[model samples]
Target: MPTEINFDGIVGPSHNFAGLSPGNLAATQNAGTTSWPRHAALEGIAKMRANLALGLTQGILLPHDRPNRRWLASLSTDYASAPPLLRAQAMSASAMWAANAATVSPGTDTADGRCHFTPANLLTMPHRSHEAHETARQLAIAFADPAHFAHHAPIPAPFGDEGAANHMRLARSHGEPGIELFVYGKSGGAFPARQSRVASAAVARAHGLDPARTLFLAQSPDAIAAGAFHNDVVAVANEQVLFVHEHALADRDAAYAEIRQAAPWVEIVEVPADAVSLADAVSSYLFNAQLVTPPDGVMTLIVPVEAAGHPRVAAWLETMLAGNGPIRRVETVDVRQSMANGGGPACLRLRVVADPKTIDPRFLVDAAKLDSIAAVVSEHWPETIVPDQIVGTSPDLALVQTVSSARAALLRVLALEGVLD
Candidate 1:
């Protein structure tokens, strides 16, 4: 039977704060600060372990080789000689947020009856544009079986695409056919709007989704201007439940009406703006929580620790839990490292609905596999990355070797080298 399997990105050894993303408030605020790569990676593994404990299937995507040598070569520069700004962009760990990896259409929702993956071009952000190639390579490997999956190249440029970060689906169960929603930004005020509506339509068409079931919605420009770079930053949906902020969509009433019309059984759980302003929602990532239906049939919200600490979010959550609601339980995980870089728990994963047995086993994990990955991370990842290491004029050979070797060690431990190459 098909089930929701979350494939999270393993934090890379080159994980650092270069402040590359323009609209991501956390990334900009923490720019030039110290970074802990080893800690970051272990935290990601811990999150996977937590989800595994919840009896949810978990999968992982290996980090892309950093200091993106190929990209540098294209620009007629190498990391050692590239300008400081360019070097930082090349070394960015933005790809660690796998939500932008691809737009996924589960077998049940597609005409071909096979899971379809369209890697996002990510053309809007300079640091992230080069990711599609590598992401496609990884997806091709993980879902390589022809009988079960179909892979498509990214939607070509002139149209920016940010993949699943701007996508949501609602249904009664993971195995059932569902309503897919594509949220695109028209204007972001100070920030460039990523995920063009045209791109969203292209993906829906490519996936062969029924027009009646696919809804193209506009993201609130106000929300985007307030640093909600992607719709996922202000909203997330799981089987039949859409946990969203009041201002997440341009027209909440119309969007909700349309949603209800398409999937009449959908339970729209809107967090009031007066209780949690868009700014607080963005900061605490209250709406970005992963809303999932666990085995017991009670829905749970997997949130970041920051949300649990925020006063307004905590109070609102307490009230919500005290009363009877679809979200019956709350679970928090520490991903401060990724959080600092503007990724909450929901940002760190790409949800794919498929039978686990059809996917490449190496890509899936259990406690033992996580143990092996954690051991490699603890033993090989850099302890710390000072700002100078990334933005300094001269290249630090020691840092370079450490980052390269750390990933190499992980690939060797997993016996999955050349997968990224």
Candidate 2:
């Protein structure tokens, strides 16, 4: 049997408001505000616990070290000597959004029958560009069994890869063959289009996916301008159901035709533009919700509180639930800290469909392990982090030490002390 495991990132100790992501509206709007790293990390852990309580498989990804010393050293600069902008980029805790970790092709979809993972280059933004190597290393450790898991280096640049954030897989069952939908943006009026056609095709080829079972589509330019930075912001899929905004794709009718041709059983739930405008969808992150199949086989939509708070979105969800559809219930999760940084429930995890027994046991989690992680966060994570404190010539260098110490405590708690090294 195939099991879907969610590997959620532990919000980093240096979590703060630097506003590095260009297309992320929340990040831009919340720029320079004080951030609560302790609360962020604990909130992340609570979300994982909630998933576990729902009988969903949960796993953890340790937070990447902030003041990314290695990335700084590569440029021959130290924290004290670097410019404030560069310093802020290096100290970013963007890795907390693991949805961009990698584009994964489960064994069921690959020709080799070995699960494939290609860590995203994320070359569009300086803060995220440094993530590929570290993410690759962590994925290797988590999926160590060579026979069942295959780890591949990120596709070279000029082709920006943003990982599973722009990719979605749909199948009748986790163990069955599935269609891999790759979404790329041609252009963003002001911001750079992060995912490219070349990168999407390359990832599909690298995973040895069957051409007949794969679909590559262009993301709507309008959606990108409306703060749909990644495809997940406007669309998401699970099993045979696809929940997407009307403006999610460039050619909605054609995309739907192709999807139906590949999987005739697909249920396309198109949220009408009149019911909830694209702007509202982006603001509420209505499509970023997690579509899951609980043990009872009824599909559930785990959404962020922001979605529930939106009057139109909430009303639309109620109408949808009242009808005969794959989504039977809608459950709300807090994740407010992540939300402030422009991520939602789906942004916090990387989903891998595989048999649990085949994966590295160390990455899996239970109630006791969640408690230990929460304890570490409470003990070492700072209540608030001021961006200015870690920035210029006379910046408070002690902030770096504090972040390092917190990461160390978390590493020990997760038994991944040297994982980053």
| Cα lDDT listed for each candidate | 0.92, 0.91
Residue 276 of model 1: what lDDT?
A: 95
Q: Write the per-residue lDDT of candidate 1 for residues 149-190, one digit (tens) a residue.
A: 999989998999999999999989999999999999999899
lDDT of 1: 0.92
**Which pairs clash in model 2?**
none
Error of 1 at 160 (Å): 0.7
**Best-performing candidate as measured by lDDT:** 1
Q: Least lDDT summed over 10 consecutive residues: which range in candidate 1?
A: 412-421
| Model 2, C-alpha of 115: deviation from truth (Å) | 0.3
Model 2 local distance difference test score? 0.91
TM-score of 1: 0.99
Give the Cα error of residue 155 in candidate 2, in Å: 0.8
Pairs in steric clash, model 1 = none
Give the per-residue lDDT digits (tens) of candidate 2, residues 1-421: 6788889988999999889999999899998898999999988888888898889998877778788888999999988899898899999999989999999999999999999999999999999999888898889988888999998889897899999999999898777899999999988789677999899999999999999999999999999998999999999999889999999999999999999999999999999999999899988989999988878788989999999999999999999999998899898999888999999999999999988898777789999998988898899988998877866457778888999998998787777777664
